[model samples]
Target: MNRPQYILLPVSPIFIAISLIAAFLLNLMPWGQFIAAPDFVALVLVFWGVHQPRRVGIGTAFCLGLLMDVHDATLLGENALAYTLLSYCAIMMHRRVLWFRISTQAMHVLPLLLLAQAVQLLVRFIVSGKFPGWFYFVESFVSALLWPLITVLLLAPQRRAVDKDHTRPI
Candidate 1:
């Protein structure tokens, strides 16, 4: 039996902004301890960087990082540095990563997330002169674990409704 294919609707820039804003607010919410609280902003930034590289690139990542830095009241460039690197990785692997299913994509995403966290940890260590401990790495793994969910949620608005009449082969 032939299956119907659903086309993607055009994603509006406004939707992207709303998602990033929502992610920022989610990141701001206290999740008991820092280790358990996944960095929603970073995840969303990576998602956009991968899916919409042309629209959301290093500059956007840097600006969002600055905003996050302001929100968290940390060293101004801490997140900017990490996010810039994350965006670079996402953009670099976008085509290759997009070819995989979301579950498989997590394997590809692991290093990028870990690197972003490492940059943040390094920045904190340099300025504060203290190691945050192994628990600090938990958030990166958690962020990777949440990648499939994040991909689904963020892509929901862009999923087009199935049109039966349009099932004819092009």
Candidate 2:
């Protein structure tokens, strides 16, 4: 059965908005060093990169990172540069990533997440003239570990909708 294309699939804007909001919330949350959460915005960008490259590319990543920088009151362009680099890496590996299973994609995403965090750390150090401590790296690890879960949870609704459409008559 041919599927109808008008099944109200959630678009890029929704994802972008949710990501930005999550980033802001994560930044605002007072974790107090127990468990350093991953950068929500970065994770979101990766998800979009893997799933919707045409709509959420490096430009979008850079913009979102800039917003993060502004929201967190960090050095201007620090997150932006990191995010831009991450986005580029994601796009470069987009085809391969799409071919991988979700679990495999999480493994693949680990390095990109780490890379983004490392770049951001470097930028922050350059701007602030000091290191942010080892805890900063925790975000990268956490993000990598959370990638599969996040991908599944966030994308499940869309997948279900698509499945429903396919099973239904046109």
Candidate 3:
């Protein structure tokens, strides 16, 4: 019997670590209610969803969200649930999303982000008997706005490499 060959994708530990650190920093930044920033952890999950889905999927999202829960001192599993759902959505849509232009992808991601926030709101309301203010949803909008910039910046190196590879003469 002949065995099939399996190819493994390169896992960039440095990139993953950098993404995690960036998420933590973004979370800790003192926005001071000026502008509600996107959940950087969510953004990183989306980045991984599009770029390295196999290595960082729903499990990573759940773990990161749990960490955020501990950090923020919110009811446990609130963000974890939201993040897990978001990661699953992203993973399911990853193929189609990868084909979209950055602008289009931003549009697509907006609803997903909103959905995640909405779920969190529901969970919070159920647990605490109070709903957060409108500003709570602001992060989703801001995240949508930042999506194009993030995608462009993150994918630049890969695009450059692909371009160079194609431009090389036979």
Best of the candidates, lDDT: 1
Q: What's model 1's lDDT at 76?
A: 100
User: By the lDDT metric, which is better: model 1 or model 3?
Assistant: 1
Residue range 58-161, candidate 3, lDDT tens digits? 88899988988998889999999999998888888889886667788998888889999999999889888997788788889888998988876665544433
State the TM-score for model 2. Answer: 0.79
Error of 2 at 54 (Å): 0.7
**Tens digit of per-residue lDDT, candidate 2, span 16-115:** 5676577667766767346686787788788888777787898888888888888778888988988998888988898998766677888899899889
lDDT of every predicted structure (CA atoms): 0.87, 0.78, 0.80
Rank candidates by TM-score, best first: 1, 3, 2
Candidate 3 deviant stretches above 4 angstroms: 1-11, 162-170
Task: Select the stronger candidate by lDDT from 2 and 3.
Answer: 3
Off by over 4 Å in 2: 1-16, 32-34, 161-170
lDDT of 1 by residue, 1-170 (tens): 25434467777899999998999889888873634888888899899988999888899889989998998899999999999999999999999998788888988888998999999998999899999789888888888999999998888887755564576663
**TM-score, cand. 1:** 0.89
C-alpha TM-scores of all predictions = 0.89, 0.79, 0.84
